[model samples]
Target: MTEQGTVLMTYATARLSDADIEALGSELDRIRADVVASRGERDASYIHTVIKVQRGLEVGGRTLLLGSLLPPLWLAGTAMLSAAKILENMEIGHNVLHGQWDWMRDPEIHSTTWEWDLVTPAAAWKHTHNDLHHTWTNVVGRDRDIGYTIIRMSEDQAWRPWHLAQPAYNLLLAAVFEWGIALFDLELDDVVHGRKSKRELFDQVRAVLGKAIRQAAKDYVLFPLLSGPSAVPTLVANLTANVVRNVWAHTIIFCGHFPDGVEQFTVAEVDGETRGGWYLRQLLGSANIDGSRLLHVLSGNLSHQIEHHLFPDLPSNRYAEIAPQVRALCGRFALPYTTGPLYHQAASAWKRVFRMAFPSHPRPSHPRPSHPRREAAAVAPYAMA
Candidate 1:
């Protein structure tokens, strides 16, 4: 039987008792320990190989595009540069800064030192993503990643008329993801609402601008000028490459985190969560994309996002190795193991964006003692869509 099929069959028969749930946690821990213990030559070789391949593509592509007026060379060079950027940002930079391979003891690859290709500073990303987002997962008010503080992702969020344009802005955000992320790091929502001081926001904005200027110079100014006669073509090529990388990363990330079956939690659901409950929350909050080896690598193995969230510090390469086991655990527990092909998952997430743009049933929220009878505590009267 296929791995997913087996999981389904198991879930058909098993019910999760307290004993079974505790055992499930233990089994997951056992697997994590085993993977942790076995991180050695294989892991090191894998990361080094990816880095070499990415660098080679970047160099070869830029060289071919340099001082060349050939249309075919421009096409090939742009494609190569896109591939290189995607690999560098996703497979290398994202995972490295996740501290996945810190056990390798390589300072160059350590999370503390590595910066990504994107405009968002690595330190800011670690604070918002690693520290806040991961810790909060899908908790509505707690996780700023819900709609990235822009779009209303659920009914729990107080919707404003501006959300009517979210579908449009969502596309825009995908096109310019790096910029959106850099802005997100500044906590612009808080800044505008007086939650964060303007002075502090200004300092953060300066840091982002500094990084942006350096990156822009490297791609559009310094490298293009180095190409001499091909300066224009090279600059345009870099621009296209960056855009492609940004869109692909944004798509893959959305597929993993916001698809149809994925659940969003309220603060109450996660407020007092235990270790096992936290694991369960992560499982429910994440979805996975089914694809070939190439897709997995380009996605930085975030294709196995379920596994990644459960063990965020684990080497990303190890995710593929552990996915089946994780699926089986979900099956044994009779919990959902959400997986879909890339297109399907992407479509599902977008559908949510569109569906949520309109008003809907009241969302489940924790009752505040002061507002025990607030109307959101129960669904409003039904109406045709």
Candidate 2:
């Protein structure tokens, strides 16, 4: 290992005995089968419940209003119960939206068609999330999610005045505008900044506009017409649910990859690296959060981020089952497995945000390019989070 906390090339090339590798592979397959079976059963019930509740609110508005001013706190608590429904939405709902669940029975369809029938248009999310952010992750030039006005992820970007003036305030801004940040990306960076081509920009613009119209129809027109004055409480319930859900979603996502130990590389660096090397860097650079089985399940097992990186095509439900094997592999190879509780990781990520927002010194030039073999050879193990 090198002084920079990167695993060395020797470690990367080290092979476990063939029997151990086969055993690990077999263990992963067994876990995948279990997850698929369990998830299939749970998700069918989950989808039915969501459909029933949404329909109940729509059809029996008066009865619902008379019985409870808002959704029963427990029902409405989908927002505040961050660990429960929000995680459920992320794990189960998201997979369903992606058509990753039972794709053989119902093949994966584009989000544009109503076949998916997501609460939100799955296409827009696929474009921003699966296509852009997941593909690029911490690459500032490409990943729209990380480049907030003041909380820039890349070290190459110049610090703004407001960023320098009030560091804590910027973080507060991030927390408050987390939902809006993605929208801003669609409008500003992706469109106005010319990051996207003209055709792609127009497509995104249409998607965003369509989503706004659908939301307005539901929140403003349909609900008010149905519930009269009682609609106020219903609106409140919906808004509260949205707030809770958004907060949970934002917090889980932000903490996963943005923590202190994660590195933000320049476009120049990323452009120069080989695909395999880049994948390895992403594995080394991202941090994972620790949580319970439900938490792991809900976050799409993204807390097992390293495994996810290593095997993106594999279902997330398989992550926890494969985690120990991956950890053992890391241990045998002396790779640092960076992980911690959610808040601890979040705090660390926030500090990095602060440093990016208010740099104490001028930014340095990009590092000179080096040979891949030499680069791999010079690597040191990352510190465990």
Candidate 3:
């Protein structure tokens, strides 16, 4: 193995003191307050409308798919179902369940009771994802999402022989990303290492099993059988739709956090962090995807992953509205605002996966970019986190 903690780091050129950090926090809070104050009928209408459309699409697709006797019908049905599942899983379910709309205080949209399309129960996932993953976005060790309990996502995670199969592991995980996330929610390593009690682990298992069984029966069994002789077609179409949703979710998510320029941090980096420090960490650690309005909606507006990380509790729809402001803030701060199209981000993430499969060394530093006003900020890995 190579020496640890030797990576070259970069930071914004605008030199910041503790007072400046607090001022940044204050400015962010102002933006947040504005968004929160603006929340009302429009935000509520957006989510409800999205949910309605998603449900309608799922039903229409299932109906057509159930009776499909030709390839064309099957294809059309599969497309609709795929779109529905994507909307449900990404735009509607994920954001609503984030309690992003919970400020309205409606029972149905409340975070505590919202269940998602994935195999993992919403409660279990929220505990691990919202509470844990968001709490520690790109920290090498503390964030289990760094590699989703499997791949080696950062240099700090020592390369292991098993990681050699990551390309295969990653592909399989993409195919069944929902199941992979469910299993990760259980933190299997904790069970094997005795960090979790047998009773607690089994309880989680039972909850997951219940959700899995329901999901399987709905798409694979009940829906198929309900179609009688057309059961075969419906089953296949449903399976295709689910796979499409899984792969899409996996790709979008991986692109957001694992792309080339996104920084990874150590726990020490965030020790006793203040509000501005936390905001800076989120800005540095997260990446974004450039895309059209439709792409943004279909990706659950997580295409604005940088804004999402910076304001996770804010309504996801608002990410788009506030992205320009956020970008402006990044420019003013001279901080790196990592973003690119979806394909480039995906390629970058995959490249990292392959490169990090084996042991690697710290990246060689080059001279900071030339700037007239000040240093052209080269993003440092953990220097400012």
TM-score of 2: 0.69
lDDT of 1 by residue, 66-90 (tens): 9547888899999999999999988
Whole-model lDDT values for every prediction: 0.82, 0.55, 0.83
How are the candidates ranked when ordered by TM-score, highest leading?
3, 1, 2
Candidate 3 lDDT over 1-385, as tens digits, reads 1125322123322344556666677778788889998999999999899989999998899888877667787898899999999998899888887889889899988787788777889988888988888878888789999998789988888888999999888999999999998999988788889898989999999999999999999999998898888889889898999999999999999998899778877765555455676787788889999999999999999999988888888999899999899899888776788999899999999998898898876443223322223122533321334
Q: Which stretches of candidate 2 lie over 4 Å from their true place?
A: 1-66, 70-89, 96-99, 105-120, 148-150, 165-187, 193-200, 271-275, 362-385
Q: What tens digits encode model 2's per-residue C-alpha lDDT throughout 93-172?
A: 55554445443354332223322212334566665666666667666566666644446655656667666544565445
Model 3 residue 374 lDDT?
Answer: 19
- Write the number of the candidate with greater lDDT, choosing between 1 and 3: 3
Name model 1 segments beyond 4 Å from true: 1-21, 193-195, 365-385
State each candidate's clash count.
0, 8, 1
* Top candidate by TM-score: 3
Could you tell me how far off, in angstroms, the CA of residue 279 lies in candidate 2 after the best superposition? Answer: 3.5
Q: List the residue pairs that clash in candidate 2.
A: 2-380, 5-380, 5-381, 5-382, 6-380, 6-381, 7-380, 79-244
Find the candidate with the highest lDDT and give its number: 3
